[model samples]
Target: MIRDWEKILLVYEQAVEELKIKFKSIRKEYRNTDEYSPIEFVTGRVKKISSIIEKAKKRNISIDSIEDGIEDIAGIRIMCQLVDDIHRVVSLIRDRDGKDLKIVEERDYINNMKESGYRSYHIIIKYPVHTAFGAKEILAEIQIRTLAMNFWATIEHSLNYKFKHNIPKDIKERLKTAADAAFLLDMEMSAIRDEIMDAQQIFQAKSTIVAKILRNIQYLYFSGKIEEIEDIRDRFFDLNEEGDINRLKEFNNYLEKLMDKYNIRKLI
Candidate 1:
């Protein structure tokens, strides 16, 4: 029994870590192309032994059938900036269904929220894990939600734990109200989503330009171009103070040209 539990936990842990990396890489790909990533961040966890046992007991699963009956032993959560992004992420996962993981079921709680006011899109998947023994398929769950929804759900989860899943009627009612408010916030943010995305993109582009320029400057300093570095530093400070992204980008181009002239390998 102990060995069985250890193997189960190990596989679930591996699944969680791999899924987190995969989802995070998707976000990184969008950022690398200077595009707005729908996925703001990802988090994952493998259920603890105690929690698993408790959940299985609550669900009335036989101990022998726990592995197959209890989903969410491995969980991945993707948080988005807007509700629309949640659907996009869900679509993305759907697109990769056959090649990466096979979708077992989908629960659209965002459209049809739970009675407890939980709002998230749940995707149950069978993920293949290659271990020393061989490839084993395990059930994992992915939850997608907007930031506002995540906030409310987090608070509700805490309350549920505190109340042992029997939250008082009064608190439950308040939670439902708060859930609606959170969804309203998401709607308002979605209304201005374009503006927010544009602002974020500009900030990201500026930050990238600054990083590249600084890296080049560091290369110049190390290459014994002290005087040149001083002038470049002053110009950079002036351009930064001007707070013009275009000018900063122009200065960055000039630095690239200068580096080329000096036979300095471009520092990305």
Candidate 2:
């Protein structure tokens, strides 16, 4: 057994790294398709040494029981744009196709906002980390919340830190009001969710097209005739400056037809 605190901390680090890698893979999988992904962004970290020690002392937990008493040593935060997205992410994590990840517990804090105005859905997962010793199962906490909720939680957390987790009554009431405002904002955004998602998808797809165009143009500058390259480049600039997505789409179509002439593979 790894009795050294340093080694145990490294194990926690390994667990966080593994979970981050897996979550990033899920994000990539969604971006490859036309579907809207619930995960806006993912971040993770292992509890700091001093913080771990403080938590253990506060909970009256022995060093040996730290893993059981302090469940958030390995933490991952997933931010979504909508409240529904938060739940979708939770389900996705639970039903995620993987053998190395498993949900051990869940806390629906979003529906049961804390008195401090904190709201987020937390899931405790068991992640298997491979080390020199062998495969070790480590518990990790995953917090899913809307971007607005995250924004409020961030500010409230800062206030709590400055006040030692005990803000004045007035400040606490104001924080609760701010939390309500954030909740309303999320609801307003979710009302037009489909429209926003469509626009975002179109914008992203256009960006991908632009990137592909630039790469192909750069490639052909050396491989193809300068005259043809310059003409295509001019057209690209004209279409871009017009700020017309339809024109851009048409340009992509043109590129597809001309791929044979330039001996270029399909861009999209």
How high is the CA lDDT of each candidate model? 0.90, 0.83
On a 0 to 1 TM-score scale, where does candidate 2 land against the true structure? 0.91
TM-score of each: 0.96, 0.91
Clashing pairs in 1: none
**Which ranges of candidate 1 are over 4 A from the true structure?**
1-3, 266-268
Candidate 1 lDDT tens digits, 58-124: 8998788888998899999999999989989999999999998999999999999999888999999
RMSD of 2: 2.7
> Which tens-of-lDDT digit does each residue in 134-230 have in candidate 2?
8887788999999999999999988988999789999999999999999999999999999988987777676767877777677666565446778
How well does candidate 2 score on lDDT at residue 215? 71
Error of 2 at 14 (Å): 1.7
The candidate that wins on TM-score is 1
User: Which ten-residue region of model 1 has the weakest summed lDDT?
Assistant: 259-268
